[model samples]
Target: MPQSELGPLKSRTPSSERAVPAQELRCGRRLSGWVLAALCAALLGCQPARADVCPSKDIRNNVTNLQTLENCTVIEGHLKILLMFKTKPEHFRGLTFPKLRVVTDYLLLFRVYGLESLSDLFPNLTVIRGNNLFFNYALVVFEMLQLREVGLHSLMNITRGAVRIEKNPELCYLSTLDWSKILDSVEDNYIVANKNDRECGDVCPGAPRGETLCPTTTLNGHFSERCWTQKFCQKKRCDATTQFGEVRVFAPFALV
Candidate 1:
């Protein structure tokens, strides 16, 4: 071959230019790794955390089951206490959750044989952000035969659902609680049924039928119908009447 045609062996291409492809390859690999890690993080963030189901078989023998429940700040699913026949109501005397703040789903107490009241269980629970599991009820207490009180004094909000108190024959205070004060608005979403009539004042003396009669009184020659006709009436007070006729009677003071 002619020397001119061979062209001086193409003077070994410059090292810097040769290194360009290698550099680009290394950068591509690094970018791919970063992208993969970012995608993984995004997926993890989108997924809901697993729920904590309490009252395991060991609950009767160990306090750890209760401790597990206490440790959760947010429960992603239902918090159900059902069929707890072994654990008596007295056993729950000291079971309190001081740090629990939210339940993202329904808080159900169903047929818990001995659970008398939830008065002390979750003292700090402030929110039940319902995920729509139990037909729009964030808190459902059903068929709890011995349950006497719906002790949700500290529960201030139910973000997305109603409250259902049913078949709790002994739940006497159901008529007295001011549900509007706790929830943002009741909006006719509360259902209280199959409870004790006398305890609920369903039949107070000289009261209209079907009305849960609270104590009546006369103030300053006025007949004030202090009754709890509506289930959500927080305070038991005599309803104001147009009749101002004077009548001698003894009545208790109705505190607000």
Candidate 2:
């Protein structure tokens, strides 16, 4: 990706030397990595062109063969389904989905990438059974007023999305949404700070022991170091012992 100094719309390189070495590219004259990815997405027509009918194969089938779903949305509308594995679905740069309005259930769904703040898109969505977001950076920024359940593991699991948890150190509250059921078993994974930013070391917390960076999540949010630790640090009263990495647990807030 090229680094644009002017704006979002103008950091493209010349078509010649398309395979030029990225490091060798002239600074201030190339697009940033993010911009480059977006350009490729545009050139390849990665986003959906039209609403293709979703195949009726089991959702799990598509999970193993993401190659088949390069041009369609997953399950849409009112339905009850069971997902039972950890699968990383590919996200087309300009993917779109149908407006969901259903009282559905996604039980035992292991991991998902693009299902960000879905509550806003599906006002009637209720009862999301056993599942973990794992990583969907855009979801961290979603406004799911009714979302009460999330099952994210480590920060590494969250590969992309927009909630901006990257710089927020005091961010412990993963979601402001309210769901009837949410599992809190992921109180032992390390959370990653703003690893993408150059100034991250100054604002972000020190990395877990033995590691040079914080635990990984879908690291796109602009959260502070305090906000990140405070939100996910476990609140259990156990024998405090220094562990190898940052603990993924939350304690009650006390302004000390």
Candidate 3:
């Protein structure tokens, strides 16, 4: 997890790493991955002394233990893919880890039934690091009944906690995601009862001549014709002439 380049006070340790500031304090609001490493460790005041050891058992084997986490890039603990028995859903086509980008803690998928798309299974998962949370949810996709598009599009981040994607009945873009751009604060986040957006007739590559980059959600605030498909878009959607690997080299906006 030391590919570095994480600006503004970098903080992502797990290879015999140490330091803690009461589990990175966590106040709230739109920052970005590791929240700039816990705000670069609280503006150099540095904190966090412990926390990271809670996966005693929970990977319910299949797909060869998820292909042995394909040389994990950082998964210190808690990545439960619970209670399996004759796993289906194409057994996760081309199941990939391709170098996971950090789980640090919390990322469960209960009743996982033939997954649909995590883009390419954790496609360079951005970050889950709730440090450790299940009851408080760091990212729980419950009852994945033939899940549709969670397509993690290089997941933005979930630093502290909150997010309980419940009863995935053919999950869709979850309203083109706008969890305050990726939670900093906002509890009770139970992205409730999936499967609705007009029965998932989602269509996007460009929302009808609008040159798609997907990210438009407004209910009481108007505009909601819903059509975010390009694998359900994410952060800016990258730039430059897209023609690369790992889904257009992490630019927070690169999936064209």
Candidate 4:
């Protein structure tokens, strides 16, 4: 070898001398894995720690059976109450979900015997974020023979579905509820059908007969008052005294 070409003999550094520590390299890999997992969870809206209380199951309208719902605060899927032919109405009178705040899917109440009202059942339920499997309604009440009032008094929002109230023969307060006051917006996505027609006449005098009348525009602009009070004014012109007078007159002329 020529002396000029081989003159520079710099000290050789081993590859191991520049290598990262094993423990630190392993920790870096673990940190990267954790970051990727966190990003995936956020994008998928994963709720791994919170399991569903009632995962797409039906709850028969039996008092003893429904006690399963007493401690459930959130239902990740549907909550269906149906087929209470053997149960009495009073048995459901005590059924309440004081802690329930949200139903991630739908809440269905159908063919419940003797269920007079829902006002007391879900008093604290504030939201129904529907990820429903069938229809788009977050809440469905159908064919409840004795259901008189929908008692969702504290319900403030339904994030992604409609509302359906139908075939509840004795339900009377549907026409009076100002749904816009409770929900963010009804958006013309409701179905109120096959309820008691005579009560409908008494509650919503001018509303069309035997059809869905949800988001009833003829509501007397009140939250819980009777709609018949303003029915005459809605149908025909009347003086202020006649409209807002404390004295009320029925068709058969009963004064109160």
Candidate 5:
């Protein structure tokens, strides 16, 4: 037969050669699948359970009953934090707990929504961390009547929870580098209001009255006119012709 027409004989060196590549591929696929499965399992394991986030108005008394101690952080007994609604329970005012006595060790924080100010609500609670806290636009004092504790570092408000800081634009009195200074400034402003205006409409009978009716000045009244004229108008305005022009010209500027 011609050499060109003859084909090479099938190599029969070993049967193992034919099966080895397929076996190696099968082993590689099995190993890849196992690695993939392990990676998937690991990813799922690290995810937080739905139970971790408490919803609004759903009060869970004795939270220790719900999850294992390991799953929940134990601050004192079994409760780590008691989540209260800022508004659902009643718009950030605070929950009315007549029988409430928070254990200091077990409860980490009390998160409430719509907090206009954080002064009195958590008087005993020195530290807090949450989302959705409204700035205290109407707060003057931080009255922690039963609290002598220390350390208030974790206090904060966030986006979606009872502790969220939102909707409080008029809370200028509560924030300052020196809160005492801020309090002093607020007190000064309050005194100014009380001095010029009759708040409860209770005029002080013992108040010092000059010649003119000074106590009659309300917050929106001409207070300086009564005060200045009452004290020194007679001594200074004996020359009425000389004073009228001066008084009239400077009257607009005095209004300011």
Candidate 6:
């Protein structure tokens, strides 16, 4: 990946001062804070993009462009860092978006082979409003072959749309979260084809009272795991309380 650091903001010399060459040019100096605001707000999407602003288009690349998002706190659009191929997890180890708090649209991660977890990359992300979605889903993590976890530890709410996480061969920490804690409904969400929970050594620690952390339900009618993570797995029983809010957390036969 090329080192594409953000360029320094330039000062705008007024047209009236053009005749005075001595005063008209002042290179290397940046505009004041108010002028910088005008530079972005006055000509939105124009050149010399703000270091903290997300790209106007969907974010994509093999490198994830961690450099471009130097001070970003809120991504107004979808946040999709994808297709980081032929790389190891450590390439992005020390790199992170520590200031990011919300992705107003959706978030998707696909074919990121080296990424083992998201705990560091988006450590402060609290909400994904899902104003826009990818195939009717707000969060999609697919084909992450080496990923071991969906480690968004600070994620608190996904206010709209469903989740789709599939085809992650080594992924864990899926059969532990209770989506009911975040989403209004888990009926349409899909979580499948990750490492089998039975074989996954990192299976979620059950509830504190020695009860099952999550209700027994088939993931997309196959893998016998329910919920999304351990923190979301607060409800410990699967009897008359099998339903976590509006989510039917058990197969019809299991409920029988």
Predicted candidate 5 versus true structure: per-residue lDDT over 161-238, tens digit per residue: 111112222222211112121111222111111111222222222235533333232223333321111121101110
lDDT of 2 at 191: 28
Local error of candidate 3 at residue 162 (angstroms): 13
Which rank order by TM-score, best down to worst? 6, 4, 1, 3, 2, 5
Report, for all candidates in order, the number of backbone clashes.
Answer: 4, 55, 11, 1, 17, 3
Query: Which residue runs does candidate 5 get wrong by more than 4 Å?
Result: 1-113, 127-168, 176-256
Q: TM-score for each prediction?
A: 0.52, 0.21, 0.28, 0.55, 0.18, 0.60
Model 2 weakest 10-residue run by lDDT: 247-256
Candidate 6 regions exceeding 4 Å error are 1-57, 203-256
lDDT of 3 by residue, 17-52 (tens): 122233232333333434443544667655432222
Expressed as tens digits, the lDDT of each residue in 155-189 for candidate 1 is 65465566767667777665445555444456635
| Model 4 alpha-carbon miss at residue 11, Å | 85
Off by over 4 Å in 4: 1-54, 194-256
RMSD of each: 28.8, 21.2, 17.2, 27.3, 35.3, 19.9
Better of 4 and 6 by TM-score: 6
lDDT at 192 for candidate 3? Answer: 70
Which candidate number maximizes TM-score? 6
What tens digits encode model 2's per-residue C-alpha lDDT throughout 176-205? 211111222222222234223343233223
Residue-level lDDT for 126 in candidate 4: 57
